[model samples]
Target: MDRISQLPDELLLRILSLLPTSKDVVDTMVLSKRWKFLWMFVPRLLYDDSHQDIDYGRFSRFVDRSLILYKAPALETLHFKLGKICGAGDLHVWIRAADKFSVRELIIEIDSSSRASPAILPRSLYTESSMLVTLKLNNAILLDVSSSVSFPSLKTLRLVSVTYPGNEFVNSLLSNCHALQDLVVDQCPDDNVTILTVKVASLKSLALHTSDDRVEDFAHGFMIDAPNLECFHLRDGTGGFCVIENDMPNIVDAYIDVSYALPRTILSCITSVQHLDLCLLTTEVFFLLQLRVVVLTIAYENISVSVRLLILQDAYPVSSIFPCLVRLKICTCETEWLNLLMRVLKDSHKLQALELGRHHNRGGNVYWSEPSSVPECVSGNLETLEWLDYEGREEEKQVASYFLRFGSCLKKVTIKPESTSYDRDKLVMIKELSFLPRSSPACQISFD
Candidate 1:
């Protein structure tokens, strides 16, 4: 370690930069006099005080001291993971120092579960941090944000569960970030933002989530105009209006998990996406017209039997929809599984792969009764069958046996039981599946 001190300042700072946390870098100063100020020039600083044993005053002092003496030419990354005990003044000073050092990336997370209020940010953060390229703030309060707030160099901004004084904050702050390409905003249940306006033209990726826990059912929503966006994920449980001002021509992938949040509006904007993962609470959505590979999340326990039938009819248009369908995945809550399975299998003429995921303690038990006629896909086209968390129930066994008895083209059947299943139970299931009649001579069974 003594010989390491002989290294030049640049070489020493570079070596210190490899440390995971700022504390590790600071601890190196005790090695020798040559190492005393080396950590101050390290490009990266990660300070986290989640450990319960940490003294608040001591933690603040260490962070303040580190920033005050930080002589890095340009801070590449500065992460502060302090809790509610940290005041705005302390954070303001640290952020100003980061600005002074020309930080490229800044991340600050204050615990939201703490008894104290959210950390209110200082005005300097929005106005002075012109050099910051990436900024992420969680559980912080954004107040007095200027309409002229400029983050010209900033490319990514994530405000998760953060509070904004008004709905205007989104449009006002994002308008100035000319270089921003990635944006994420996960609103808290009580965030005062009523109508978030995301009108950035340069944005390439956006993930926006709004909660529905608020008691009032106001006309809340979003106004989007990002035409160049390539990736989008929207989970709006608030059942609000979402207006897309322009078409997203460059969209490649999207995941939509919404509830009564106007499925038509959601579909119109994501017309050009190459891939989509959709989740809606009701059966009003019917965009799976051209689905080749479909993943259905089934939780139809609470829904009335008539509504469930309507969901199958409207959501998955069987006659023409499954003609071209090949692969299907159903992550279900064990709610009337046989009805949904038989409906799809009956029409999916070219279906080849089937994957069933059974989530425990959800919905209701599925009682399987043999179908009158074997589907064409099951007897001829089906090649692979996968069951995740297979409980080896009698109903499950009957369904498994039915597939084995009829699937002439079955290549492999894989079964993964729940973690709590005993080794003896697994062996029993394997033996039972092995003894079952197989229509295909080369069919293989696996349980592991």
Candidate 2:
């Protein structure tokens, strides 16, 4: 009568392991007598309280029952996503249970807003968990760890919005993890860390985000010495990692978002990056030598990082050759974007697609003027242009007219006007754009 349920327990447990949550696997007991206790034998368990109408009392009881009665000798994964109602005492017991099970992967996410301060994790999590492979703690607290601790199997560790005791605690914790490969530290305000130091030798990926809003907040410096890093993401509001030392010849991709200017040492680190996403540039850090897919920024003196899928975010484009670029997306809301667009278009000979982002009300100081000559990409390689939330102002019409008239190889024009624009005005704008003479007779205009 039940063909699927009649399969062997091992095969059923394998399917149960692939489930989204352990709750669903536990609920499968209603299927038949064969699955009545199958959940207890499964080596993986995940519990999240975000589901509908599940309060903390019910969530805590279910977790306690599940962990206490678990028959699995060696758990590979034990995850918990709790809300603010969960007390820190329960977490201590759960972390101890994970240690006893020798879990390989442990992820704990607590709603940090529940308490005045983040709950400090049990020290055994740092010292005793030799079987852990991946550990992620969100909205947690880390006390000062001595040099005696070690995580021999830890490879990926993420501490998001986590409060740290001090800089020494960070260095001590990282140094103990000899096998760490991926590390992320997104600090919270009032976090005691002033100087974040990362000196992992086996690390391949590192992402650091620190914010300092006031003058008193001290997230001032960074000392990184990872020679084998392949990718890193750094977002520092107060220029914390500007003067970082050493080079990463193994770096293949890098994402940097900083406010203050950085020195030459920062550029030397990511010279071999094949993909880069850089925002808010204040210094002339010269583009990467092996850049491939890039996120551009504002006010660059010279453009050098040539990559596919280029994004320009509210900045003037400097005159620079982009030989490797194929697609350009500009999201500057200002109406005075013709110069910015043309400058980039002139140099990107291989460019094919262009997307103009939503126009904003606050216009820039610069006025629109026709380019002296049509750009090479416009007449040769350009294929498609999309204007989102097209306002169809006088300057906007000039941009549309210039591109339609000169783009010889253009294939399509997609215009999505703002919903607030008057129907009559939209019709007139569409008519004007449709009537504009195009160098490519096969080009099609799409209006939405």
Highest-scoring model, TM-score? 1
Query: Candidate 1, which segments miss by more than 4 Å at Cα?
Result: 2-15, 18-20, 211-220, 239-250, 261-278, 282-330, 334-361, 364-386, 392-413, 420-445
The 10 consecutive residues of candidate 2 with the worst lDDT sum are 289-298
lDDT of 2 by residue, 1-448 (tens): 2888888988888999999888898998887788889899887899988554677788888889988888888999998876555665787788888888989999988766554666677776776678899999987777665546688999999998787777777888898889999999887777777677799999999998874452422125567889999988887765333434567888866765554333234544565654444443321222331121132222232322321112222123344455655666654443334554666678678878887763234333325688788888899988998887777888778888888999898999999887889999899989989999998998999998
Model 1 C-alpha RMSD vs. true structure (Å) is 7.7
Q: What is the lDDT of candidate 2?
A: 0.71
Deviation from native of the Cα of residue 293 in model 1, angstroms: 30
For model 1, how does the per-residue alpha-carbon lDDT over 346-375 read when each residue is reduced to its tens digit?
A: 866887888777433443356788989999
Cα lDDT listed for each candidate: 0.74, 0.71
Pairs in clash, predicted candidate 2:
none
